[model samples]
Target: MKIVPSSVQLLLERLRATYTAEEARLRLSRQAERAPERTLRSAREASSANISSLWRQLGAAGVEIAGVEQELADQRTLEQAERYSGNIEAMVGTVKLPVGVVGPLLVNGLNAKGLYYAPMATTEAALVASYARGAMVATRSGGVTTALLNEGVLRTPGFKFSGLIDAGLFVEWVARNADELKAAAEATTRHGKLIALEPIIDNDIVFLLCRYTTGDASGQNMVTIATDALCAKIEQDCPVKPLHWFIEANFSGDKKASYIGLITGRGRKVSASTVIPEALVEKHLHVSIDRMLAYGEMANLGALLSGQMGAQGHYANGLAAFYIATGQDAACVSESAVGFTRMERREDGLFVSVTLPNILVGSVGGGTGMPSQSAALSLLGLKGAGHGAALAEVTAALCLCGEISIMAAIAAGHFSSAHEKLARKR
Candidate 1:
């Protein structure tokens, strides 16, 4: 479609004074017409002929707009590509847990006293056994608790910025100096939400990650612009220099992190009498359980895992389509797909868990307001109050479960026949 005509532009300029970016895009397009220029020319003519014809039309209309319409078409083409890139994640299979592991699960399921959801139910199985065992080893010495901290969502105005800033102060300033932040936000034609997190862990560097919830369509552009602005501000205000900054992590561009999402918790305690026999470890788990135990290795030592290795689950492709059809900030999925699994040996048994910090899931706002996403959320029974943190926890659990299942099968030498067998006609 052609850009709005000058007369239409005058009308829209007045209306746009109050329009949001999304609204403006729609209004402008609605008022525009596809002036698909055609010219009588020999087949040998160059492609530039289309541009020349479009320029002639605008020139006759007394509009002084720059560039031929083809250029505008090219610009939009690039933008469209950028918008989907973040949502289009790579596909790696799901990883499974080791074989024959068993244990108790102690999730530090506490909260700010009055919050509604905190239940630590135990799911007994080979997988749960391994997780509980690992937890015991990690906490054998004592004080091995898992805490759930949530850095919730923040809304962004329809504006764009280009700079760095301390996210803590930036958000605080947004709160204390609402007038100024609002003014800045109102100045741009773009805006989105930003989510920041600071790990409660100590000794190690603080983890500052952010997720920008771009409303409707892909939010890649909006997030990039907003973060650039925020980062610029932080660089100017904060005293401590940031070691690194990224727009996307884990895979979904929507999920970014200051550092890698890691597993950090005390190893559980395991009693010698309760420990899985060393022979069983090598035979079933395929790992040297005896050596790990003797190395004075905290039986509950933490494990660093890789991406999905066995199961075929959600990939970047499905997520992108899901985001598009649902109206989510598709790019956030980049950071959301960094799936991982962790294992630690516990006195009672080995602990196995999965962690995916890049899970950019939501049930309200934008796409959640759409019919399809709402239906999907309802199907999962997550419609009412679950937010970002709950999704992250669940995704992490899924990864860990996969790990436990995979490892168990591998140790038992059953993974191939159980999950990976491809049947053929006899």
Candidate 2:
């Protein structure tokens, strides 16, 4: 007789009771009250035990398992990809994302400069095509010039004092002892370096925005650990101890679409720009330069009226795709895509630029090491430490190209038609 090598959980559960010599009745203590112990025992004794009683119990309760049959088909191979430990509550197999490619885009940046392909994982049908069209235009018009605009990661540690006077005194003390505070913070991590400790006073609270230069990782956890270390040191040595203190006061603007993160820049920020001649715009984008410029103004006005944070055309589309393909923390897209896009006609042609103020990324951390995600990064040749900035510049250049194609597609009355053909074909 042969037993099926089944789901590890199902195997463990069945054998635990059988080998322990515990009767099925005693084992069903946490089980449903409806199924009598005798029936459970009979079900367990059945030769085809794995799919018998428990599944029947769940099925009787109006639950379905057919859809998971295919998902669990290759349980063994899927189990090997399980990279999580200690924090493991349960392991459900991976869901697949459809990854596509757009670009042979040209980017001129301080760290990365070349023609590159962008891998985009998205469900939207016309998304990759829109970006490809944008990249095509940029490539024809030379390339987009990119710059590393700013670099910093912040963790806001908040403190509460009895009165405003105490808060003011605390702020002064922090300012005076910045060197010592930095030393304490630096003790926690090898890669994170303490750069700035900015204090903000609100009533009786002191919000110290602890900023750091994180080398290769996204640095959220790095900065948080270091700041906690600094906060502990402050609690021990400061003359006026805070009435209450918390690790995060929400000022770091981790995921929020705040103006502070937009201006001060929470993570890697890069700007990509290009000047496309009027004739090239017409040939590739199928729109006149003057009309495109007019449309830019109109779009800007609409964004202002709608209270939108980012005025660019479809910044999220490219950023979200790139993030998914590169295995970034997807939630960062909320703040990462928030920026200003400006377009002005120059004597040469058109001046188009996009400033992505925050692109929280890492080459050595998070999900970047996962099998498929690692392949994606390696495909782009982005590897090792200090490559995070290079990724940001590439992403910004992709965004610039995407913006150009989309704005032009809309201006040339191709938006609906393009989507109708690519997005919803019968």
Best by TM-score: 2
TM-score of 2: 0.83
Model 1, span 274-353: residue lDDT tens? 23434445554565643433332322232223323212223343334334433455666554444333445776455444
Instruction: Please give the lDDT score for candidate 2.
Output: 0.82
- How many clashing pairs does model 2 include? 0
Highest lDDT: give the candidate number: 2
TM-score of every model versus the real structure:
0.37, 0.83
Candidate 2, residues 222-278, lDDT tens digits: the string is 898999999998999889879899999988888878888888998988888999989
Each prediction's total of clashing residue pairs, residues at least 3 apart in sequence or on different chains, is 73, 0
**Lowest lDDT block of 10, candidate 1:** 264-273
lDDT of each: 0.37, 0.82
